[model samples]
Target: MDSAVLSGRSLSRHFSVKGAAAPVEAVRDVTLEVAPGALTALVGPDGAGKTTLLRMAAGLLAPSGGSLSVLGVDVAARPQEVQDRISYMPQRFGLYEDLSVQENMDLYADLHGVPADVRRERFERLLHMTDLARFTSRPAGKLSGGMKQKLGLACTLVRLPELLLLDEPTVGVDPLSRRELWEIVRQLVEQERLSVIVSTSYMDEAERCQQVFVMHQGRLLAAGAPADLRSRAEGLSFTAVPRTGNSARTLQARLLDARDVVVDAVPEGGHVRFIRRPDASDGAVAQLLDGLPVNPVPARLEDGFMMLLRAAPPPPTLPTLPTSPTLPASPALTPPAASKPARAAGPAGGADSMIEVRDLVRKFGDFTAVASTSFSVARGEIFGLLGPNGAGKTTTFRMLCGLLPASSGFLQVAGVNLRHARAQARAKVGYVSQKFALYGNLTVRENLDFFGGAYGLYGQRLEQRTSQVLEEFQLGGQEHMPSGQLPGGFKQRLAMATGLLHEPEVLFLDEPTSGADPLARREFWRRITTLSEQGVTVVVTTHFMEEAEYCDRIVIQDAGKVLAIGTPREVRKQADDAGNMEDAFIRIVEQNRNGGAP
Candidate 1:
């Protein structure tokens, strides 16, 4: 019995464009095998060719060289035959937004030629698993990001496919939603014996798979069990805590900026977690983190990821930032409601409160989007708002930024009332949305200049600001590259660079690192801590719960209501679990769902 469901031998894919000098090699010669009933994952950074490889496996993409097969059938030669036995959900699945949930499912079933007798039980089971039974009649467009993803999966599973393919299904979704989606997949794989190949940026997700494939720049770097990869970098990983008065972020920045020796560094639970090169001398490693408390910790999939990335070419070079930076506000960058910077007394206790919300409420007709949410953030603080997608995190942020009106509550930002002095509040803050909001057709330099000019910078001021951001984000040579063509990690950096061009008092990042790789995440947060230390208030929303550990304080929301608010340690103590952010988060959310509070 040859139990392998998918196998590729010297498989390669390439694209030729009219204007390009070199043809794009999306997938190079690669050999791999996925067994039946196995959960296999392809993990890598943005533009690493995960999607292209998945397409080739699905038969939607024809390999320019070599050969591939699915379930013993040649995919390239008999795509339609192979397609009939598999389900593939691309990165951006095409679902009819105007149709009702039930309608969309029915349409997909018709396309797949699923018989009526099989539809009854299949539809019911899918609706129950996805928690969409109650929303069957609701329009697909009205669903939240998480619910939409679930619906997309349900549609793909309308018929029993021998294999399933998911491409970053949880990219922009929150932690809770991600858990639910994975649960649905795991159930099918265990019970129905369906083989699966999922491409993802999350190391945790990749660890859940039975086998993992590491991809980088269209090449397969490594393939093995999660534990095997973790063992490859075991002794090189460490968790270090800075001495009193020196923050973990400061140490992380120091280690990361020394890219010549260190591979990666990130802030985790008040400690600097990093990976040192295996070949570095004892003196070199000791001098890197002098006067720090260091301890060896067990390596994980992420450590292996960094190890492989270090062996490859270094990522784009980010410019060193100064201890202090000056950001001036201009009429173009400020929101329409906020025309001037707020210089009055801080919200509550002078500078203690940079942001304040009291009894906030937002209603959409008969349903409430946010309910009696109250929290305050002090200057120089990194505050996090986390919850399942569509749990009102965005709504709360919009009200605070004065972009959306709160039905009932008082909101203040930077010592100014958001409702009354919206423009002033806008002038005091910078925002980076979840989606890439820059001009797709414009080059990186063009986008930066446009944003700078909007911030009221002109002539030399614009030039200086653009140059600073370019260097700070390590985006020097990207000036002429089209913003749309840049990789996912680079796109995120560009968006952040544009937001920081004007330098407001506070920064708001909505899932800023959603699809970025491990190294990119470390680099992103290092700059954030530096900004917070410089007296700037920071408020961010994220799906990655581990990131919550880096914040001074965090709030969790669900069903449009506040569930818990405290430091990472405090929240974990309440859970009585293993103390990891994921464990704590699951405990808190589950307790809340069961009508209990921590």
Candidate 2:
């Protein structure tokens, strides 16, 4: 404890709400130790107290019933002393939007009272490390999502504190940027001997840490090296390829529901990876699969985490949202008939191509945001659009949603040509933006009502559809709660519920699971699976490479150009038989950037 950079004992935090029955216990009797000059990770589902513990360590919040020491000093007794030696970056780092990148760094440096001589060297190194050297004069708001995160990290490091505390630093960052950020943190830990404790939702990031603390519902479930933690799931992990004529997600949903035999399940590499109950018979998982062959695979850190979470399950979340397959289709939501574009049928049981894009182009002044990209999405299929930040994924998504006009080429959604009937086409699809674009001030029900009306639903129809979605999305009780005060998972539910009120034939989701925890993400995907099974076409963009397995097919884009498009298996094969989608995606992107060199 004396040598530890930071240590806590029986830490607890509680917050009072105006209408709540009792104070919310954000953290409860948690004990932890973070080693010096090494990376430590805090990981768990949403509302797991990771952020609360980090804030307590940073002296921003006081623990209700425990002691925390930072660098051998008692944080509660002398928070100022601890604050002087540590730098804390919250999930939403305060970057002045109008300030230039260099200006933001300078502001942080000045606030920290960094010596002028030291600031110069530090700024130079950080700029080069973040690859923002050429963008120093660009306004922070003008930078891409990944670049903004990089700038926030650089700003946080302006003074080079002895300890660094980061709360979900890479929440909304793309994979390439996430890798770069980890590299920067690792370099600091190795070269500067700066100790870092970061909270992340990405299991892969936690795997890279020297120590990991798993939390659940305000308590520490386990703490150890990643390997030590992974041992808990040994011999219980397996990968089962779905039988012919079934999608990976369908199998995954089935496995996830069999709580008696399975702990967790997800689609990966065109197969379902699952964790079986230790006490279950060997044939339990096989029987669940209806005699499908199941091969045992090495357990991963994620497998262990899932096991822990299952042992201490959180509140019952949306297992599966109801899909109104029996409801009649609304005439106003029907797509206009248009000339068919010649294309092969897509997987996932779609009868016809619902989305057709050919030589699609979009430009902003002289810069092309999307350059002649082409792809097709089938009705009842889940199609993914993946790319690094600033790679034109959002721009392409906007064009498909009919929110923005394409510069040229053919584009259609739900049989309606986007160019000729943008409004009509918009009515046929539901769109959930990357950010929470709903009115935060409104109650959940109010936001639903407003959006429902905007979609042309009337008095009785609007009320009926709104009520149906509210119940199906498991947002029934939260209808009266202020949307902003809701938890992350609930906010996501509200957003998704709002998008589905009018029951559009096609749904477009842009990074819907960004910053969401494992439980929330699983629930979201389960709902998506149900929707697809009901013949609703789904188009989505995501940074989670594993999620690509859920898609019937995907298109990888970079710098406004399509690098690869195929099923996850085919894409992986193209990248030298990469073990997983993340590896395959990295290899393909790097290869293209390296001029197709192996």
Name the best candidate (by TM-score).
2
Q: Over the stretch 124-160, how does candidate 2's per-residue lDDT look in tens digits? A: 9999999999999999998998899989999999998
Which TM-score value belongs to model 1?
0.89
User: For this target, which candidate reaches the highest lDDT against the unseen true structure?
Assistant: 2
Candidate 1 local distance difference test against the native: 0.82
lDDT of all predictions: 0.82, 0.86
Model 1 regions lying over 4 Å from their true place: 1-3, 16-20, 241-247, 258-262, 281-294, 315-349
- Can you give the lDDT of residue 206 in candidate 1? 93
Q: Cα RMSDs of all predictions? A: 5.7, 5.2
lDDT of 1 by residue, 1-598 (tens): 3568888899889876333446767788988888789899998877778999889878899999988998999999999999999999998999999999999999999999999999999999999999999999999999999899999999999999999999999988877789899999999989888899999889989999999999887778899999999987899889998786555556777888776668887777667788888778878888887857789888998998888887887543322123213333221222211322333222333447888889999999999999999999887778889887778989998888778988998999888998788887887788888886889888788898888777677899788778767667767655766777666888998998888778777789988988787767876787776677566677999988778877877888988999888766677777884347777777888888888854
> At residue 329, what lDDT does model 2 achieve?
24
Q: Which residue runs does candidate 2 get wrong by more than 4 Å?
A: 316-351
Q: In model 2, where is the ten-residue run with the lowest total lDDT?
A: 331-340
Clashes of 1: 9
Q: After superposition, how far is residue 373 of candidate 2 from its true place, in Å?
A: 1.4
Q: Count the backbone clashes (under 3 Å) in each candidate.
A: 9, 0
